[model samples]
Target: MNIKLLAVGKTDNESLQKLIDEYIKRLGFYINFNLEILPDIKNAKNLSEAQQKEKEGELILKKIQSADVLILLDEKGKQYTSEEFSGYLQKKMNSGAKQLVFVIGGPYGFSDEVYKKSSGKISLSKMTFSHQMVRLFFVEQLYRGFTILRNEPYHHR
Candidate 1:
């Protein structure tokens, strides 16, 4: 199955970009992984948080295909151990999911509409991280999950 990561805005830090790129390249060896970055909304300063989320939600929805299983990287979402996450990935692959799209929303988070459209959510941590930082963290976890699935020595018990 193809795995796609859709996130709002760009990762401006060169150091962070390098790490994210490394994981993306590593992931390509295991699956058809693609990272799609949605442009940050212009004139966002004038819009209220709700307005921004609504606009961002609209853009997010447009990127999703009918058959895609969309999952949000949300704080309120389900948390899983590395092994459990590997099992979750295996389950999706076994079910023949065409595309697994995981989204990292904008600064203020997702809208009600986006929430309703998602298949599920996965939380990386209970503590919050910057939007750019989350991209790197999520990709690393994804790489770790795949390695665990392959019985590699990357993940420790």
Candidate 2:
């Protein structure tokens, strides 16, 4: 199955972008992967928190196909161990999904519409993280998951 990561805004920090790129490249060896960055909302300063999430949600929904499995990276979502996450990845692959779309929403998080459309939600940690930083962390974890699946030496356990 193809894995796509859709996130709002660009990773402006050169160092973070470089690391995110490296993990994306590593992920390509195991499966089809793509990182699509949705441009940040314009005039966001004037919009309310709800308005911003709504606009960002629209852009996110536009990219999703009906058949794609949408997973949101939400703080209140389910948390799993590394091994368990690998199992989750295996199950998605086994289910024969055409594409697994994971989204990292904008500053105010997702809208009600976006929440309704999601197949499930995953929490990387209980602590909050910057949207840009989450991109890197998620990709690195994805790479680690694949390595665990393949019994590669990349993951210690």
Best by lDDT, which number?
2
User: Which one wins on TM-score?
Assistant: 2
- Model 1 misplaced stretches (Cα beyond 4 Å): none
Q: Estimate each model's TM-score.
A: 0.97, 0.98
Writing each residue's lDDT as its tens digit, candidate 1 over 2-93 gives: 99999999989999999999999999999999999999999999999999999999999999999999999999999999889999999999
Local accuracy of candidate 2 as per-residue lDDT tens digits, 24-57: 9999999999999999999999999999999999
- Model 2, poorest ten-residue lDDT window? 148-157
Q: What is the Cα-based TM-score of model 2?
A: 0.98
Residue clash pairs of candidate 1: none
Displacement of the residue 3 alpha carbon in candidate 1, Å: 0.4
